[model samples]
Target: MAQKSEIEWTDATWNPVTGCTKIGPGCDHCYAERFAERWRGIPGHPYEQGFDLRVWPERLDQPKRWKKPRMIFVNSMSDLFHKEIPRKFIDQVFETMESAHWHVFQVLTKRSSLMRNYIRKRYSDRSVPSNIWLGVSVEDKPHASRIEHLKQINSPARFISFEPLLGPVGEIDLKDIAWAIVGGESGPQARPMAEEWVVEIRNLCERDEVEFFFKQWGGPRPKSGGRLLDGVEWNGFPWQMVPEPILERLAS
Candidate 1:
């Protein structure tokens, strides 16, 4: 069975791989890491190893088994393109996604270059499957370059996550992007997010005709500050990128 998710954008989570090492500031107070570590030493717990990188071949076909069509967040607990994961395992993951064409798979990663390279090599002779949406996480202005990497990919379903928005992401282009989700960091030590910073990105998304979603104004908890931006909630989604069959089912 698929693990239901609380994330606003997706319906469920699929983690064939679990646990990850931080790669940037966005990962500093990772919610996944914190959640996994809590079960570190509990016998028979899924996270007994406590955020240590591990691959579960058994979980590879979870999506295929779920007959109902739904949006699945791929590897919510870990980055599928993390350096330590074997290329063979990554291949298996992609194979499952490609075969499970009934669902939309949201694959996000901080290793932008790796994801770009892998996608290029895997789909060199064809386009990426529309069901597989690729994205990169950018925490600040410096990491905005990841967007450039994402733009190079050949998929029309590309998106970005600016969650844990640590600092302003200055002027950046969102051309050819399908969607963007922005939010402040949450947790015990959540950092504050500025209104101007979010407005800047929302304006950019509008200018580029990209979908904009304001996830939260995060604080001690995800809902502490409420998600209203200028007295409204932004729940933009790229429906055009979803496959026709999936779209029909979702709408039904």
Candidate 2:
């Protein structure tokens, strides 16, 4: 867990679970995996074992320990709903988010069905907590089903990250989704993403009233192409979905 993060959208990162396996085209050049693997064999480092799925139960309470409120990206280093993560452990993560109600928790994952199922069972008897946001990461059209799975969830604070968007997502209905973040792949072997593809998604977001955030026009480095979309930066954020209490905290 970190008190601060460089990610433009969030204030901090909480990795109660660290490390993950690649599961989709979006994971092909995972920045998280690249970062974690770099510390492998360095004894005493948090990632000494590399990008292998490992849960840090001790870090579950990190959010609660912080007195001030912030936007916390949950499991930024791993997918919380990875098939190997036990339901009980997922329960622990949920419990922590509920307890640390002061902070907004952003949980993004590529394992859509698993995330949908877990949230279904956990919040079956009640509504999803407003402070906890659930989202999915998709690289192209094939994984668009992840967006559908997210729609099936109980939360109003649902979002999608089309980072490393490799191709057009085609026709999609973003009726209930609160936000969408789109960006091209970065790093040495980054794949190319078409402008028409991005504009299509942006137009869809415009029609559906979903907040659209264009992260970057990624190249060899994340900022290599800068973050301009049609000569303007799209920095949309879903503040309306943020709970009133937290909104008040941020306002103060």
Candidate 3:
């Protein structure tokens, strides 16, 4: 993983754990899997075993080494709540996040139920730290239930990734959601995303006053079709939930 990232929304990526399995249609053309597998069997490569669900305890303390504050995308290459991962290892990850309060940790997962259940048990008596944002990946209408699972969490900094949006999400509530990111899929086998699909979610984000960001219109490449929706770039982000200390660091 890279300390600096090109992801339009986030400043950096921190992958203390890497590798994942395909759990849904969204995982069909995972860029991470493709990249990791290419280097499989090559001696000494980080992904030498390919995308086979591996954890790096040595990397657990990575975030603490970065003295400057950053928007760290936790596990950009894998799903943190993957059932294969041990609870003790996951606890270590959380401990680092809690200790490194200066940075904002964006934790996302396709395993919504697992994530919700874990969060509830971990912080049962208190609230999820504001600096640690929680979100889910939604690709189509059927998976919209993940949104409800995400809503059950007590975190205020909640968001959704309607990326590689395979189909329209239909009518769904955006209440309690702080941010929403919409984008088309990118890869050699990239699927076409209808303009109407983007508009439908954008309209809802407007209605609910949720910060909305249009990442890109995918093709063979991520920026192939550009990120314009009705002749404008939608770069909405939820700054209200950002802890003032982090904001102050960012401003400096």
Candidate 4:
């Protein structure tokens, strides 16, 4: 069975691979790393080794077993495109998503270039399945380059996550991008996210005709400040992008 997730955008979490190292500022207060390290040194725990990059080949086919149609956040516990993960293992993960057309798979990675290259190599002869949505983590303006890498991908199901929005993402080109999720950092020592920054990205999405979702106003907790952005909730999602068969089943 798939582990249900509290994440607002997606319905469930699937981690065929676990653990990762921080690569940038957005990872400073990583929730996944925090959760995993708590169980470190525990005997027989899933994250017994803490957040040190581990591959679980046995869990590769778990998604194929879920009968109900639902949104699956691929590798919520780690980045699938992390350099250490074997290419063969990555291939297995993709194959499972490809085979399980009944479910929508959301694959987000901070390793933007690696993801772009891998996707190109894997789907060289065929187009990526519509059920699979590829995206990159854009935490601030400097990392906006990742969006370019994401755009270079051949698939049309592209999205961006600006969670932990640390600074203004100056200006971005959201063309061809179907959805955007923006939220502030939530945890101890969490950096503050200004309302102007949220409005800036929201305005950009509006200009690009993209679905914009304001996840929350970060504080000690995810809901500390409330999800209201300028007095209204933005729950925009790319509903039209969902494949017809699965969309029909989910709607029923």
lDDT of 2 by residue, 135-220 (tens): 99888889999999999999899999999899999999999999999999999999988899999999999999999999998999
Q: Native-vs-model 1 lDDT?
A: 0.95
- Over 1-252, each residue of candidate 3 has an lDDT whose tens digit, in order, gives 557999999999998889999999999999999889999999999999899899999999999988899999999999999999999999999999999999999999999999999999999999999999999999999999999999999989999999889999999999999999999999999999999999999999999999999999999999999999999999999999999999999999
Off by over 4 Å in 1: none
lDDT of 1 by residue, 1-252 (tens): 259999999999999999999888899999999999999999988999999999999999899899999899999999999999999999999999999999999999999999999999999999999999999999999999999999989889999999989888999999899999999998999989999999999999999999999999999999999999999999999999999999998888
Order candidates by lDDT, high to low: 3, 1, 4, 2
Q: lDDT (CA) for every model shown?
A: 0.95, 0.91, 0.95, 0.93
* Stretches of candidate 2 exceeding 4 Å from the true structure: none
lDDT of 1 at 35: 93
RMSD (CA, Å), each prediction: 0.8, 0.9, 0.7, 0.9
TM-score, every prediction: 0.99, 0.98, 0.99, 0.98
Itemize residue pairs with steric clashes in candidate 1. none
- Compared with the true structure, the alpha-carbon lDDT of candidate 3 equals 0.95
